[model samples]
Target chain A: MGTRQRIVVAGGSLAGHSAVTELVGLVPEAEIVWVTGEPHKTYSKPALSKEFMQARNELAELTLPDVAGDRPRGLRILRGRSCVSLDASGRAVTLDDGERIDFDQLLVATGAAARMPGMLRGVDGVFPLRTLDDAVAIRARLADRPKVAVVGGGLIGCELAASVRAFGLDVTIVERLDTLLDRPFGGALGSYFLDLHRANGVELVMGAMVERVALEEGRVAGVHLADGTEIAAGLVLVGAGSEPCTQWLDGSGLQVGDGVLCDAHLATSSPGIFAAGDVARWTNPIYGLRMRVEHWTNASAQGRAAARNMVALATGRQDLRKAFADVPYFWSDQYGQKIQMVGWHEGHDRVELDRSGDVPGPLARFYRNGRLIAAAGVNAPRVVMRLRRQIEDEARAAEAA
Target chain B: MKIIVDRQRCDGNGVCMGIAPEVFDVDDDLYLHVAETIPEDPELRARVRQSITSCPILALKLVEE
Candidate 1:
C-alpha cells in the first residue's frame, strides 16, 4: 500500500460536489472516491423550481461550473451509483450494486427527497420538483397547459406556483398552514407573502389539507382537500416538503434522527465519518441549536468546512480541525420579487416590522432578549444582507463573552 | 483580476457580497456593483473566486490578467 489514505464522499449535489472539490485540493496524496448517484454533473437545485421550471434557463445552463481546480491523481468518480449501506466499524460503504469500498474517512451529503403522499404515488400527472428529473417531467407536463394544483405553500410550492402562474395557467396552492413561508420568515412578514401570491393571480387555499389526488384514467385529474372542496387541476405538483436521505445509514451505528446527527464540527459518532447538507442535523454554535438546514448556502459552506476536518482526521492532524459556525441564509425569487431571510428564527420572541421606507422594501427583524436573531425582507438585498453580517458579529461577540 | 456580472440574469441575491464585500456590493435598488479591479491578495482572491462560484444565479464571472 502506497501511503494508504482514502476518503469516500457520497451524494452528487452541491454539498458533495463542494466537499469533493475541497478534498481534492487538501489531500493531494490520499485516494478520493466520489459516489455521485446522479449521472449528470452537479447543478443548482434552487433553479429547478424557478428558472428551469419556467423554461427561462435551458437544460445545459443549470450545470454548475467545475470547482475542482486541479484534479487529484488518486481521485475516482463513480457516477450513477449510490450508497446502499455502511459498516462503521469495518470502515466500508456498500454500493447499490453490492460493491464495497473501504475508506479511511467518509462524508455523507446525500441531501433530501421530496415527500409525496401515498394517494399521489401512482398518479401519472403528479410531480415533485426536488431533482432534475422531476423538474424535467414537470416542465414536460407544463407544455400541456394543465391547471396546476400545488401542494404545500413552502418555498418550492410557492415558487413553482408563481412560475406556473407566469404561464397563464390556473394555479391553486393547498397549504396546511394558514400563511405562506411561515417557518422561514418566522411569521414576521405575515400578510406580505400571502398578498404577493394573491396579487400574482395565484389561488391560495389556506388551512386546507390535501386529502387525495383525484385521478382519471391513471393520471392526476384534480385535487381533493379535506375542507370538502374538489379543485379541478389537470395535474398536481407536490411540494409538500422533504425527508433527509438517511435510510442507508440505518444500522451503521451512527446517530440518525430526522437527519444524520453530528457535532458542531460536523463529525458524526464514528471517528472518521461526518455529515453535511440537508442530510445533517448538527449543533450550530451560533444559535446553540441543532438544525438541519436545507438552504443552499449552508450546504455549500458546511461541505467545505467538513472536508477540511475530514482531511485533518484522516491524516492524523486532528489539531487542525475547526468547528463550523454559520448563520443560515436563503433567498427566494418569486414573480420578480426577491425574498431573503438570514439567521435562525425558530425561537425568536419579539419581531419589529419596518415599512417606513428605511429599507428598500418591507422588512422585519426577529429578536430574543433584545438580540437580533433573524431578519426577513422583500427586495431589500443591501439592508437585509447587512443585517446578516450584524447577526454574525453579535453571535461572535456572544460566543466570546 | 476583473469581475463581470450578467446583469440580465442577476437577481441580486447579494450572496457574493456576503462572501467578499470588498469586491462585490449590492445597492438598495438591488443592483450588484462589482469592483473595477480586484487587489492581488491571494487569500482575498481565493474568497472572491468562492464568491463567484457561490452566486445563487451564477451571474458573476472572473477574468484574471
Candidate 2:
C-alpha cells in the first residue's frame, strides 16, 4: 500500500512515547517506526523524581500505553537506536548505526536530558536525578545510612533530598542561590521552603558553590565549597537544570534559539517536520512569553498537539494551527507540603496578593499589570483553579482586543 | 444533548466550569462535574462544547441526539 505513509518518532521518553501513542490514534493506518536511545520499554518521567526514588522496578510499570503493543497495528518499535541526523533534503532520518528510513512526516519529540555538573564519569559519588538509571545509582547510596549531599536548590534537588531524608539518610542541600526553586518562585517562597526543609531535619547550606567533589578510593567522600569548606557525604546528587537535546540538530538548517524554534502550532521551519515536548520552544499566548519547559504537562500537551498537526500536514488538512495557551503549572512535594504554581509570575511589576497570612490555603503570591497573573498554593487547589480561569479570561480579552 | 468528561485527562485546571458554570462545576479532584438535572438552555450545551474544543487534552465530549 505504498509504504503506508511512514511516520517516524525519535526519543522514547514521556513526550516521545506519548507523541507516538497519540500519533497512532490520530492515524491508525499510518506505518509507525518509533526509535528510542534507550533499550528498555518506556515509563513515566514524573515518577523518576518522586516514586522511582523509592524503588526502581515500579519505574517501568508507569508506562501509559505500551508503545510496543499490537493495538497500534502497524507500529514498529526500535530500541537502542538513536537518530543521529535529520536529513530533511532526503526525507529520511539517519540512525547512529548508519541506517536511514524515509518518512512522509517526522515528529521530533527528542526530550531534554539533565545536566551533570563537570564530568560525572570519574567523579566519585556524583549523581544526577533524571532518568531511571540515575535513580538506581542514587538508591544504591541509601544503604548503610549514607551521608547525602545534594547540590542545586532546584525542584528536583529539593524533592530528592526530602525523599532521601525520609529514608533516614543524613541529607543536606547545598544551593548556589540563597533559596530553593528561586527562579520559579523568587526568593520569598524559596526562603519559606528553606525553613521547611531545615525543620524537616535536612541541613540547608544556602549561598554556596561546590568547587569540586572529593574522592577517596574511587568513591565520593565529600564536597569542597568555593569558600574553602568541605562537607562530608557518601552520596552527592546534582539537581541542576537540564539542557535541551538539540545538539544533533546543529547545522541541520533548522533555526535553534532556546529550542527548536516553532510557531504557535509547534511546526518547525522545514515542511513535514515538527518539534514538541522539552525540545520545542513554545510561545505562551497568555502573557506573550516563550519558554522550553520539561514538565510532564507541557510534554504531554505539546506531544499530542504536535501529533495532530503532523497528521494534518500529512493529510493536507490546514486547520492544525491552534496553539497551546494553557497556563504553566508546576508541583513539588517537599517537607510534607505540596507546592503548586499556576501561571508565570516571575519579574512581575507588581505583587497583587501575598496571602502568607493564610497559613495553608490560598497561601499565594499574585502578580500582573495591576492584575492577578499567577498564584501558588499549599493544599489550595481551588485557588489555583480560580487563578487559572482568571489568566484565561485575561488571555481571551487580550486576543479579542 | 449532555456533556461528558473523561476524568483521567483532567488535571484540575477547571477551565470547563470557568467558561460555562451553568453546565459544569468542579468535583473533589477539580474535574468537571456535569449537571444531571437537564438545563433548558441549549446555549449552555454549545458553550460547554466550545470549552471542550479548547481543552488541550480532549477530555470533554458531547453526547448529542
Candidate 3:
C-alpha cells in the first residue's frame, strides 16, 4: 500500500471507541489517534441510569471489555483531552490543548452532552444524569438520603426515577408533557406509564413546568411548578435531554444540523470526513427519514458501519462502501419491567394495539399508510423481536417500492 | 470458545441475540439462551465474539480452548 494512512478519531465514548476497534482490524498499517475529553471512556452509558444508579453495578464493572479483535499496534489514546475544532478541507483536528492532528480521514463521533437549563446550573445537589461521573455523584448523594425530584418524564427521567425509588426513597417526576413518551404511541401508553410509576411509589406531576428550584444554603430544597405547586426535594436530578457535541465543527466548513448532517452512507459534507453516533443526524434509508438516535444500540452499530465505509474510501475501493440502514432498537428497564421498541414510531397514521391475554404484555404496532413501520412491547422479547424482523422486511419492501 | 453468562447481572436485554441470533436467543421470559455449539464459520465466529462484547451489561464472558 502507499504510505500508511493517518486517521484521527474524535470522541472516546461508545461510538468513537467502537470505530477504532473496527479500523484496527480493517487497516492494521494505519496510524489512528483517538481523542476524548472524559476519563472514564468506553463505559456503558445505559447502565448509568439503571444498574449503576441502583448500585447493582460497581464502578469497575461499568468498563466495557475490548470487542473481539486484536489490539491496534499503531494506535494512540489521549484521555481527558478533547478535539476542540476541525478543518474539514485541510483534514486537521485541533485538540483542547491547542495541539493539531493532521489526518487523511476523520471520524466525528464526538457524541452528545447533557442539556441542562440555566436555572439548574451551579446549584449543589443538582446533577444531570448523562455520564458515569454524573451517576457517581448522584449515587454518592444517595448516602445522604435526601428527597429526590426528577425533571422530565422521558426515557432517562422515568428510568432515573425508577432507580432512585428502588432505594425506597421519595422521588417525584415533573414533566411538561401531558403524558410520558406521548410521541412514542400518541398517548396510547400514557395510562400504562402512569400506572407503572404510581404503583412504584413515584410522584408524577404531568403537564407542569418548573418555575424554579427553591434552594436552602445554596442547595436544592424544593422545586416550584409554574401552576403554583411546590415539590419539596432535597436532591434534584435533571434528565431533560442531550444536545449533540457539534460546536467544535462550527465554522469548520462541514455541514452541521442538529448534528453532523450525513447522507445514508454516513458521509459528511466534506470529502474524507464521516460522523456517527448521537452527533449525527443522517437520512435513515430504512424509513426514508432524517433522524438522530441517541441510544446505546445505534451508537454501537453506527460506529462499526461508519468505520467500514471509511476503510473502503481510504483504500480507494469506492464500490466497497455501503450505505448504513438500520431498524433502530432501544430497551429500557424500569421497576424490573423490560420495555423495548424496535423501528420508528413517528408519523404513523394507524396504530394496532394488542393487550390481549395471549401476549406477555401490552404490544403496539405502528403503521404508516398501511405499511408496518414500528413495534413496541412491554416485557415481551421473543414476540417483539420477531416483529422486529418482520418490520425490517416490510419497511425495506416499502422502501424499495 | 465457551461462553459463560453471569446470571445475576444478566437482565436478558437481547443485545447479543440482536447481533448473532443464530448463536444467542432470548425467549419471552426474558431469558437468554446460548447455542450448545458454535458453528465453524469465520464470519459467524467474529460476530459471536462481537455479540459477547456487545452485551451492554457485560454479562457474557468468553473462555477460549
Best by lDDT: 1
Which tens-of-lDDT digit does each residue in A1-401 have in candidate 3? 24879998898888887888888888888998888679765889999999999999897898886533435588888888999999888889999889998999999999999999999988898899888889989999998999999998988899999999999999999999989866644565777889999999998899999989998987899899999999999999998889999999999999998999999989999988999999999999888889999888889889888999999988976855888888888899999999888888888899888998688888889888988888888988888888888888987787677
How good is the docking of model 3, by CAPRI class?
high
The window of 10 residues in a row where model 2 chain A has the poorest summed lDDT is A56-65
Ranking by DockQ: 3, 1, 2
What is the C-alpha lDDT profile of model 2 across A301-336, one tens digit per residue? 677778878887788767654677777776666655
What stretches of model 3 exceed 4 Å from their correct place? Answer: A66-71, A184-186, A317-320
Shift of residue A112 alpha carbon in model 2, Å? 0.8
Fraction of true A-B contacts recovered by candidate 3: 0.71
Q: Could you arrange the candidates by lDDT from highest to lowest?
A: 1, 3, 2
Off by over 4 Å in 1: A67-71, A316-320
The pairs that clash in candidate 1 are none
Go through the candidates in order and give each one's C-alpha lDDT: 0.88, 0.74, 0.87
Question: What value does the lDDT take at residue A341 in candidate 2?
Answer: 78
Q: Interface Cα RMSD for all candidates?
A: 1.3, 6.3, 0.8
